[model samples]
Each structure stands twice: as structure tokens, then as C-alpha cells.
Target: MRRKKGLSIFQKLFIAFLGVGLITLTISGVVRYRAKKGFIERTIKSQLTDSRERSINYFNRTFTIPIKKDLGFIEQSSSLNNFLTSQRDEALLTKPPAERLFLHFTKMPESIYLSSRFIDSKGREKIITVGKKRVRDYATIDHFPNNVLYRRIYSLFERLKEENVGSILFEGPFRYKNNKHTFVIGISKMEPEIGGFGGAIIFLCDLTGYLNYLSDIKFNQIPIAFVFRPDNHVMLSPEKEASPGPDLYQSQEENINDALFVSSSIKLGSNNNVLLNLALIIPRKIFSSELKNALIDSVLIGVCLIIFVGFVAFFISMRLFAKPIEELSRGTGRIGRGDLDYRIKIETHDEIAQLADEFNRMTESLQKTTVSRDMLIQEVNERKRTEEALKESEEKYRTQFEEALDAIFIADAEKGIIVDCNHAASELVGRAKSELVGKHQQILHPPEEIEGEFSRTYKQHLKEKEGQALEAHIITKNGEIRDVSIKANIFEFKGKKFLQGVFRDFTEQKRSEEEKKKLEAQLQRAQKMEVVGTLAGGVAHDLNNILAGLVSYP
Candidate 1:
């Protein structure tokens, strides 16, 4: 087998140092990435939420101001309803509210027009229009009207009665018999004093103008703007027919739905085709362009900083690692060429300096060891000779065998015949050493013994060339039985094979173990009886108390 070439101290140190540094750098980069990404996401989401809230407030303020101002004007106008009713001679009185409404339209600005209608208790209705154009002369109670404008007006009145609201926002196409145009209308129920009876004041505003005004508002540099209604209507979308162009209205609807339902931040697209959906229901009012620019700047700055830090780390690692490794390499080369006295001498406070110190100590030890190499080899040879002599001395230990405190014997494997017996063995079996010799060992053992115990042990030792040891009961010459431990080993001396059996009489140990087991069993039985007595006493006391309670109750 070929041995692999070992790495030099410098090579090993360099690899270990680089591995540690790389791991540290990787962990730091991951931590920084997660922290910075979380910060950016949180910041953008907060800003978007704030912007949407502001936009909703702006819309409410702008839309409500004009309505409030117009209501104040109507309140100050001199008995406007009476003036209109008095102007009606019987011929004018019979005029439908729609025609009379045209006369009142002259009083409004060009930006607004009025229409009116009345429904009696019988469900009959009078339709009126008071706008830039006239449509009716005398009052006409109509059961049904085909005009979209009148239908919307009727719906508004019905809603007002049901909800008791002053006005509603309605959007749709309004068609007269002669013309059709899309309109957004605000309708308010007129009090009885305003028009001589209960009726509705409908203000029609052109949808196109309102949409144009909304689009014209500067939303920073946002490329599009639109209005989304609650009913899934795109009031002013950039896409006319949904042909894949950017649809601001749809985007706003999605944002609003998320804001209202999911209440979460949503990302849409990128710079070249940037799409951002800011939830309108958030407390923030979103202006698209300003938020986009802020996010783009943040991302660019973060990326540039990350790259700069990585480059700086790379340069620093090279400077810190390369020079020390080169110096260590030269020192290692000298050591490898039999210059065991060579030492690395680099001064630093890091792991590299510690490595250099360790390398110096190793080299010093190696040099000292080289000086003592011949003496060490001679000492090892003397130890081997001494061990061999010790083994020979042990083989001639016949005196120890005879005088040992423990019983010992030599026997034949097949016949179990004792070839030799020590003084202790003779004393244990109650026979003289001379008498025990040539006697079968099984004569001192029980007949109804563990089957094959000695035979199997002898066979195992013969096959493995190892010794076997076990404890068993044997009968003595006095007919007394005792436990004895027997250790047997196969040995061949002078071409005669024999088994060396060393015996240790353990009769006293066996008696002590039997006494301990009997005491433990008695202790367990005493504990179990004590527990049973306690349980019986508790049960008797409880039963006596229950019997006394029952007798006293009667």
C-alpha cells in the first residue's frame, strides 16, 4: 500500500485559514442581505400606504367643496321655488317639470345643467328638464321614460327615499330623443319649498371634462392616471378597449381591492414597463411616479454598496493571507530537507501567528529528537530482550504454582485427568498431591452438570489458541461440594501437550452472594406487606366513617 504525501504545515494552515474566512464572509453577507432587503421592503410599503391615504383625502376635499358652495348659493336665493310657481299662469302651471327645469337651467353656470321630475302617490310621474336645451312644454305625467337621463334620475330618487341620503354619484350614458352623451350626475332630492312640491334636482356634468381634469393632475412623473369605480367600471382608463396597453383604471382597481380586502403591498412590473399597485384603501394616498423614483434610487444604492464592500473584502483577504503563506512555505521546505532546526518566525495576533508559534515548537522538538535517535533505538531493543527473558522466567514458575494461596492443576484435555496438583489444590479437594495425580478431574465434579461446558470451552480455546476461564461446582474428597473458578490454557512442553488449569476456590464468595439474594427477597416482601396493610387500614377507616354518617342521618 502506498502512503499519501502529507501536507506541509504552511499548506494546511493556509487552507484552514482561508476556509474560516470564507465561512465568516458568507454568513455576514447573508445577514446583511436579509436586513437590507427587509428594510427596503418595509420602507416602500409604508410610503405607498401613506400616499394612497393622502390621495383619497385630496379627492374628497376637491369633490365636496364645489357641492357645498353650490348648496349655500341655493339656500340664499330669494324664494326660488315660489318665484317659479308664481310665474306659472294656468298654462305655465300645467307645464311639465321638465320644461320648467330648462327655464331654471339659465340660472346655472355653463359647467352645470338641471333637470327635475316628480312622482305622485298613485305612482304616476312628471318629467322635467331645465337645461341649456328644452325638451317639454306642459306638465306631462309619464308612466315610463326611455331617456337614460330620466332613468338615472328616477333611480337616484328611489335610492334617496330608501337611504335618506342627500345626493349620489352616478355615471352612465344619457340619451335624449335627439342626442346622446356620456355623463356623471349628482342628484339631490329637493325639499317641498324649493320647487312647490317634493321633487329631485339633477345636476349633469360632462364625464369627459371630469376625466380630463383628473388626468391632468401632476402625479410626479407617473405615465398614466385613471379613475376606478366601485362597480368594476373603468371611468377613465388609458386603454380604450383593453388591447394590452397599460390600464391605469384596472391597476387602481386591483390596488383598491387589495387595500380593502387583503390589506397588503403588491408589486406589478419594472422601469421599462413599470407597474406599481398602491392600495387606495390604505391610509396613504399613492402618487405613482414619486414613489417609483425613490424605490429605484434605493435599489441602485444598495447594489453598488454591496459590490464595493465585496471588492474591498477580496483585496483585504489577499493582503492578509498571501504574504504569510509564502514565508511559511519556504520555512516548511527547509524542514523537509532534513533541516529539523528550521523555524517559522512571523509576528501577528491572529490564528496565523499562533500557527507559526506551533510550527516553531514542532521543529524544535523534531531537532531534539533527531539528536537522541540512536539512543532511543538501543533502548527499544533492550526492552524487547527483557520482555523475552520475563516470558521464559514465567514458564519456570513451578515454585509459585506449588506455594500459591489459590488452588492450581495441570490436566489432559481429552481425559480430564489431573497430571499435576499444587498444595492448595490438594487441600481444597481433601487429597494429597500424589493421590490427586492421575485421577480424572470429572471424579470431583457432579454428574448432572451443565452439558458440554468444559468440552465446549476446551474446543474453543484449542481452535482460537486462546485461554478459557469459568466457575462451576465440584465435589471434594470429603464429599463436600464447593464453587471453584478454573482458568485453562493449552501448552506444549518437550513435545507433550497438556492443559494448565489454575483454580480459585470461591465457596465463601458463593455463600455470601446467596445470603445477599435471600436478604433482598425478604426486604421486598416486607415492603409489599407494609403497603398492603396501610391500604387496608385506610379503607377500613373510610368505611367506618361512611357507616356512622348513614346511621346518624336517619
Candidate 2:
């Protein structure tokens, strides 16, 4: 026969430690990567949501609030109305409302107004003024009576007469005369004297400043602002020209860049009448780099950790196990190779050294043991008989413990902790023997008795050598209560005293006694009824005899 070689314990242990280390490293790496990646994604989404809210407030404040303020001032100004209606002669006042409006229009530089004008109900220009530039070089024109655009302009003026006071009308980022991105807003003017619709005060708004500010609104150094109509018409964008780009409502990849987009619907002014979509766009690449770096670092650290663990396992196994086991094997080989006086020796004071000492002692005692082998066998036989008798006694005790009708419990005398219980005890408690053992004596009593009656009785039982049969009730695992007569006796085992208890369930006997008392009471009542009936019969007989005597005398 040949020996089959297998992996040594040292080799198996090293591989096991290495495998566990690698698996742990991989799991931790994956968890860390996911946590960092999720954090980055949440941060991006949060920024986009915040941008949407800010855009709503921005449109309302920058564009809506200003137009509202202008209309409010105009509504309160009587001087402007008097000048437009031409109610009085110029001799009435030197400073006229026409001159006041022109001065206010010139000061509209900061407001970015290209031109401000007043038109009558009949499509006639009442007053007009330009800002920053002389002459009419602006994209929008007030006087275009005979041109192709005249009918369109006149139609707008007629519509202005139908619109109510404080209503605002707007037109384009359209290119007409100049290649300028401009818009015209018309506020309906009212005739307060008749309270009728009168005319319109229109302003040509230059949006170049707004577009530049829109360009400057950057996220992570990328221009994010976009202006578009509800119909997806591009108004102003970071593009060099108005070009149809990717849909900003959904996320997608493009040759230009992949981006995060958020859209918010807002009116250009205070009136909810006209809606526009304002969006912010940020490049996805800006956030990707940091997340990638975090994952790479984790993988690298995990690989290094696996390598370190493998080296530590190898070092420990060689130093602690390999050398001691090899020396023990060699020393045992010398004893087996026919040297009776040889003794195994190992310097290390570990289990391997103890094994060597055991081998040496066996070799030294071998001759003496062989000479007395028959005597040793006879002694062993006697010891076996003693053990068999002890086992038979234990068998008898176990039989009585299990077969008894009364539940029996063995508990430590001092602590009252139940150490052993019979099958009958389990049946009485409606539980398993395993469940009853290791429980306190108080467990057999009701909850109300604990810490009061049970505590006092347990203390009293500790002092007594034997207990008198006491009437009690025990609650079962099924929440049923049964009357029992219980008694305990203290017995000594190895100088420590323990309590052995016996319990007899007598709930049915108590019920029978109560029934007997009730039956005696019923018998007494029946006897009293019989005596009463006899007395009544005798009284009737006496009355009959007296009546007979009276009748005979007559």
C-alpha cells in the first residue's frame, strides 16, 4: 500500500485566510463605490431642482415686477394723461406732461428701453422718443404707414384699443430692421374721463443685456441658461445663432456633450397670460471624474489589503505549526525503530511538547505493564461490575421519576433554581422538560404571589428539612389554573443540599367536595317541606272532626 498525499494543515489554513481576505476586500470595495456614486448623483439632482426654483423667482422679479411697476406709475400719473388727451392750452403750464414723459424716457437707459412711444386709439403716434441713439435706427418702427408691415402694425394698434387697462402685450426676439434681438411691449392706455379704452404706451425693450447675463449664468463653468417658448421655439440661448438643439426636457447624449437639464415654466411678466420655458443645462462629465477616481482608489486599496493578509497568514502558520509538528514526528520514529530507552524531546512548551512527554512515559512503563497484564485485566473486570451496579440503580431512580403520576421537581436549595424535572412535571405545566428545567421555583406559582407570598414561602422552605403538604394553585403554559397539593424535602448530594418536590393535581377533588355540600343542603330543604305538609294535614283533620260534632248536636 502507498500513502496518498493531501494538503497539509498549514497550506489549507493559508489558502483559507487568503480567500476570506480577498472576498471581504471585494465586498467592502463594492459597497464604498456604490455609496460614493449615489452621493454624487443625489447632489447633481438637488442642484438641478434648486436651479428650477431660482429661475422662477428670477423671471418674476427681473421682467414681471418691472412692467407692473411701470404700469402702476402710469395709472397714477394725471400729468401724462392730460398731455396725451391735449385737454388744455400750452399757456396753462410751462412744464407740460409731454416734456415730462420725454425726460423720463431719456432716463430709461438703466432699464434698457430702446424706444418709448404713445399711440392714439386711431393708430396715430402721439409722442415718441429714443434712448442712447439719435434718429430712428431701432429695429421696431412707429411710422410705417405705406409699407408691407403697415397693415400688421395697424392691426396690432387696433387690438390695443380692445385690450383693458393694465393688460400687457408682447412681441418677439425677432429680427426686422437691424440684426438686433429686441422686443416690444404695449401697455393698454385708458381714458379715465369716459372710462373707455383709449390707446397704448409701447416700449421697445433691448434684451442684449439680458442675453449676456443669461450667458454668464454658469454651472461648473458651463453656461446653463436657456430661454424658449411653450411651443419649443428658441428665443435666446448660448448658441451663436438661434439653432434647434437637443430637447432640454429629457436627458440624452449628443456629439456636443451629455448634460443634466431642468425646466421651469414662467410668464415673461406678472400676468399669467403668456408662458415661457426657462431651463438650465450642466455637463454630466463635470461630475463623472470625481466618482471614477473614488472607485479606482477603492479597488487599489482592496488589492493591497488582500496581499498583506496572505503574507501574514503564511508567516503565522510556518512559525507556530510547521517546525513543532516535524520534530515530534521524528522523535516518535526513533522510539518505534526498536530503541526502548529513547525519549521524545521538543523545546516548545505547547501541545506538541505535551504529546512528546506522553510518548516518553508510555515507553518507560511498557515492561512493567506487560508483566502484570493478567492482574490488570482482573481489576478492570471488577471496576466494570461496580459501574454496572451504579447504572442499574440510576435506571431504577429514572424509572420512578418518569412513571410517577405526581409531578416531581429537583431544585438547588439556596437559589430555588429548578435543575431537573420529570416528564410528569412537563405535563402538569403543559410544557416540555427542557422548558421546565433551568426555571425558578416561583414559575410554578401565580403572578400575584411573586415578590410577596412566594418570596416569603421560598425563604421558609430553605430553613425546613422537610415540608408539610401545602394546598396551592399552578398556572400552566396554556393559561389554565389547577389546584395542587405540594411538598418538598431537602436532600444532601456531595455536601450541597437540594430540594426535591412532589405535586399532586387535585382540582377535580375540590370540585367534588363543593358538589357534596350543595347536595346536603338540598336534602335538608326536602325534609323540611315533608314536615310542613304533615302539620297542615293534621290541622285539616281536627277542623273536620269539630264540624262533625257541631252537625250531630244540631
Candidate 3:
């Protein structure tokens, strides 16, 4: 297998930062998505619940009126009932009995109340009204008796008795001709004027129009309103599929296929015992729209966040990792090309910075220790020129030093040992330069002056820096004592302290001064003798002249 390529520092940094950004964004997105989804669900449930409550309240308002309430209008009219039973042919509702039934039935609404007919104990019509204009007594109903329409009514009544009945019975939904539906509402009554005959007032209702009206009720036209049986048959609906489905009738509230079905009982008649359910069908998209919108927004926001963090990571990788490493690489290249002075300028406070510092130090060592042949030669020549200059300067000063009349000695200030002496100092000490050097400064002086005059002068030179000479005596190499005046001072050279003293020899001069004093004393004595002899000669000459005269007289 070939060698696998490894990721570079920049690649590693890019991957690390980008991966971290993605992970963090993923976590945040998940949390935000969950929160948004939950909020949307809650809002949908709240809206659906509110809509269900409002629908119940609305249906309650519309169906509150009972259809069975005739206010005892037909039941209390005994004369009208007896006349309706006695009449065979009712003429245009002109008979008092027919006119009373017509006017009474007219009070019922035409939409739900199609017609009202009163039956005697034999179940025959005494008075009947269809709509506002048509009226028929018991004779007229026998001719038109129970058409496909009335047969459907009687058939519906059969279905009504099976239900839980109250003071009034509400039933229906018998399929009429032209695909219409019919319902019947009735109550048993006793007419005392007609031999206490047991009878009933049955109303034929146009249920299709009323059911359509109820179905048409909607909230902003979104949900469909309808009535359904326990068997899932749609009694009335805006869509009118006839059979909605088997699942809808499971409960008062249900969710099927992502849609919500909320139902409330539509109670009718005086007893309000008719159990019809008004179902409000809410589709899937209406309530799910909140969750859908939240999903879209969360995806968009998550994408944006990931992109922004990735961009930031790109720059961070470059600044923190790539740039420094590139500089170090360039520095290495420079060093390879013999530019040892080149250094990486890395500003990062990390291991990369430490590497740069170590690189610079290695480069510095190379600069000091490693060089090309021509560079070595140039350095050597430069050093030779410096050495020649120093030697020439030392020779110029040494000539003046050696030709000096006074003897000079240099000693270590800390060691009190003589380090160097000029030629004159060697001669004054009566010893060679090698013998005098490396010895103590006190060794040049007499034994008595080692701790006395010489010691004071040496310590005073260190204390006062520079001062006048002190008279001192030294023993020469030949065993002669020499008198000298020593002047010493402290000075620093090459990071060390040194003491230098100049010795002036005055023994021969002192002897010449003593010989001149002895010569002057002898000359003074001879001159005094000459002066006395001259004065005696002058007195003798006078006395001889006088003695010659006195001897002649004596």
C-alpha cells in the first residue's frame, strides 16, 4: 500500500472548528425545532378546541326553538275539532273549522313546517293545510291520501318511535322523491268535543331546506358542517357524500387522517330528546399549517446559523493555525538557503510561538557558529586588523612608559601583588622585570617599612584614588638601601581593579648636597686666617718703624 497522506495543521484546524460548529448548530436547531413544533401543536389544539366550543354555542342558538310547540292553538279548539270531524267537503278554508286549522298551521314556519294535518281516532285528516294557500278537509286528504311524499312521512314515523321519545317525537330522514328528505313531528291528543277521540296532530316538514341551512352554517367557510347518524350516514352535509366513513362516528371528538372531527348533539322538538349530531369537519391542512410553517422557518434559520459559524471558523483556522505555520515554513526555507538571520514572526500565544522562539534561537546559534568559507576569511581579517590596531596603540604608550624618569609598578588592588613593572622600575629596584613582577609591592621596600610607610601609602592609594608621594626606602638587589618617594593610585582595567605606583629615587642627590656643605665650611675658615694675617702685617710695619726708632733711643 502507498503511504497515506495525513492532514496538515490547517486542515486539522479547519475540520475541528467546522465540526464543532456543525455539532453545536445541530443541537440548537433540534431544540428550537422541538420547541417550535410543540408551540404549533398547542396552538392548533387551542384553535380547534375554541372552534368546537363556538360551534356548540352556535348550534345551540339556532335549534333552540322546538317545532312541536303550537301553543295549544289546535288542541284547545274543541269546536273547530268537532266541526272538522262533521265537515265532509271543506270549501277554500271558508268553513270556520277549515279556516281555523289553516290559520293555526300558518303560524308554523314554511321551511321546516311543510304542512300540518289533524287526525281523528281513525287516523284520518279532519283539517289539513299544505303551505299557506292549499287546504283540505278529511274528504280532500282521502283523494290525495299518502302520495310517495306522505308514504315517506308515514315510513319516517315508523323510524321515529324507535328513538328515545319525549313530549314530541322527532324523526326523519326518509328519502323523498327528487332526492329530497322528509321528517315528521307529532303528539297524541284527546278531543272531548268528538266523543273524546284519541288523535294526533302530525306535521310534514321540508327537512331538506332546513338541513341544508344548518349544513351551510360555517366559521369563515373553512370547516364543513353536517349531521351524521351513528352508522356514519350523512343526513345533511354541504359535501353530501351520503356516507362519510365508518370512522367519524366513533366518538364525540375524533381525529381521522390528520383531520379533526368535533361533534355536538342537535336536540330538537319540545322534549329535546332527538339525538342528532352536528359534526364540524376540519381538514388536515388548516390546523397543520402552523407546524408546517414552523418547520420551514427552523430549517432556514438553522442553515443560516451553520453558514455563519462555518465562515467564522474559516478565518479562525487561518489566523490561529495556517498563518503561523506558513511563516515557520518560510523561515525554515530561508535558513536552508543560508539566510540564517531570517526569523519567523509568529504572534500566536501557543505551541507554535514556542516553536518559533526555538527556531530563532537555533538560527542565532548558526549565525554565531556556522559560516561560509568567504565569511570566515572576512571575519578573521577583521579580527587581525583589530589586533594590529591594539598592538600599535600599546607600543606607542609603552615607549613613553619605558622612557620615563620615574619607575612605575602595576599591582592587583585586591591581591596586593605586583603584576607588571617597566624597565626603569626594574632598575630602581635593583632587580629584573621578572624578579620584581609577581612579587608583593611591600617586597620592594625595606623590612621596617613593609608595615609602616609602605603599608600606609598602599592603603591610602586605594582609599583616596590618587595622591602625592610619601618618602620610602628600598633595599636594592646588591644590598644597598635606596631612598625613594612613592606615589600610588587606584584604577580599573578590564573589569578588575589595579594599583599603579611611580617611584622617584633621590639617594645620589642627597649625597651631593652633603659634599657641597663641607666644601663651603673649609673655604670660610681659610678666608678668616687671611684676614688676621693682613691686619697683623699692617700693625708690624708700623711697629717696626717705631721699634727701629726706640732701639736707637734705648
Top model number, TM-score? 2
Q: Considering lDDT, which of the candidate structures 1 and 2 is the better prediction for this target?
A: 2
lDDT of each: 0.55, 0.71, 0.68
How do these models rank on lDDT, best leading?
2, 3, 1
Please give the TM-score that candidate 2 achieves against the real structure.
0.44
TM-score of 1: 0.33
User: What TM-score fits each model?
Assistant: 0.33, 0.44, 0.41
lDDT per residue (tens digit) for residues 1-554 in model 3: 99887987777877887787678666866677678766765555566566657655654543334453462455556555555445456433435654556456555564456677655555456566776655654532234456665664454344433333224565554655577666666755555544343555667655565565555555447436677653456776666553456556446765566565666665666556644566666666764676667777877877787788777877777678877888889888888888886888988889989999998998887776745666889999999999999999999999988888899999998888899888999888779998977888887876776653346568777876476788778888887898888898888999999988998999998778888888899899999999999999999999999999999994
- List, residue by residue over 161-275, the lDDT tens digit for candidate 2: 6677767766654543466566666677787577676777776666666656667777677677787655677776766363436466333222234765666666553245545
What overall lDDT, based on C-alpha atoms, would model 2 receive against the true structure? 0.71
Candidate 3 yields a Cα-based lDDT of 0.68
